[model samples]
Target: MKKSLEKLLNKPLPVDPFMPQRAVITDIEELAPDHKKFSFAFCDESVNDSWNHIPGQFVMLTVPGAGEIPISICSSPTRKGTVELTVRKVGRKTEVLHRLKPGDYVAIRGPYGNGFPVGIMEGHNVLIIAGGLGIAPLRSLIWYILDRRHRFKEVYILYGTRSYEYVLYKEELKRLRERNDLKCLYTLDKFETEEDRRWADRKGLLTELIPMVELEPSETFVAVCGPPVAYRFIGKELLKHGYPESQIFVSLERKMECGIGKCGHCQIGYKFACIDGPVFPLWDTKNLPEMI
Candidate 1:
């Protein structure tokens, strides 16, 4: 626990919060339609060697001339050295990033946001729910827990996507599905082909899959990331099942510019999502105005 505690991303903070570190794109894999998984290594070996972050933290990536955007780190801290970011082609910044090739350079700052407190989650059953691109950050937490499976009890991964074609990490999810240690369930909104039906364990909204989990409500900690509209439904579903609001965490999607919270673009109530969150207890959603 001491070693893990020492590695928390909030360690004294970086000397220069605004300075971007140069990193080279090592590999690029097409994850889904308009989405790509990028592998990066810091150009300075010292920076790479010193890097450490929790599961739900994100980085501010510069898209050369276009601008910068915050993206979640999809790689587990357990697998150090090379970092991974799964980006979807959405707006101007991401559009430019999609055109980059392997070996091209990019600048990034952060490992930002208050990440999931995995330490507290240890010794309890884990419920991870993801929808659409929300799986990006949850992927990091999934690997972190999987890599140290002994620390936790039963683990369940419930992921829902629009269709088979839009599901990211197809091969990786297949491998996880084959594993005996954890339960992996998937749902799809539609099936375009016979293969799509075969891939999905169920068909419907992600909320529909929640009722199927059989864990003791008090002994589990839930992490959810998905469409903002889905939060209220999911929160109610979990509460209906007797899970405590304090133990349920959600990674929020906010338009954060300056990762240090000075930009004020990601304000939720009085708190800034960039520094205070991006990851917050499910209870916050209820107390905070317009949170969901």
Candidate 2:
């Protein structure tokens, strides 16, 4: 059985890290004015099911005549044969991507970067906090844990957006709220309408939700992904709540040109965000002041 398992694990997969593969878009869903969720499949079916990636890893995508950009894999590995990317249009490459319709083919490479430590998180209560577009990568972790719910203890999710219209993954969040196995809290920066007030459980900074949830500092793992401005404030709150710096993980956003470490665009202090992380623990990043 061990030999068979090793063989299965070693099987080849599509979309090599260095070589770009052709993938056809199967569906597209517009989550917000500037954000869209894209679903794709490798044009070659044989390698579709073989591609495996952990949550929090990212892939570089290429749009012909435009350029390539790094995007987080939003779908869980449990959903085999397909990959999802949630893109927010901010630059030329993303603008071109936004114009693409279903059935278009794009070049894809890599499931790059060190991801969240799922092995260590197993059997521990998990708290995931995502702000704005940061939810894209964290969503992968959320789904992975939910799929194997029995392997984990308590699970809690805190998501904050700019407003009700800016909320990403609204339908799925609603479904998550219905699940008895976990708990979810949604908040917005400001509430404009009566409906908005009624829709949200809270309306303020996401950090406010931290104190409301019950957490076991020693047995709980906290994963945070958000804007650079949110780090210091959120980190301070988590520490105040009794979580050790080592048990708290953060995902940093950097300008990455090449998906590999050769590019200097994503270099921070002595480490490369592309290879060393997009996800890192406080213990590993504390000395690197620029990362926080």
The number of the candidate with the highest lDDT is: 1
Per-prediction TM-score, please? 0.94, 0.94
Global Cα lDDT for candidate 2 = 0.89
Best by TM-score: 2
Off by over 4 Å in 2: 1-15
- Alpha-carbon shift of residue 23 in model 2 (angstroms): 0.2
> TM-score for model 2?
0.94
- What are the per-residue Cα lDDT tens digits for candidate 1 across 1-292? 4334446753433324367989999999998899999999988665676688999999999878998899999999998789999999988889899999999999988889999989999999999999999999999999999999999999999999999999999999999999999999999999778978998989998988888998999999999998888889999999999999999999898987798978799998998999988999988989995778
lDDT (C-alpha, whole model) for all candidates: 0.90, 0.89
Q: Stretches of candidate 1 above 4 Å error?
A: 1-17
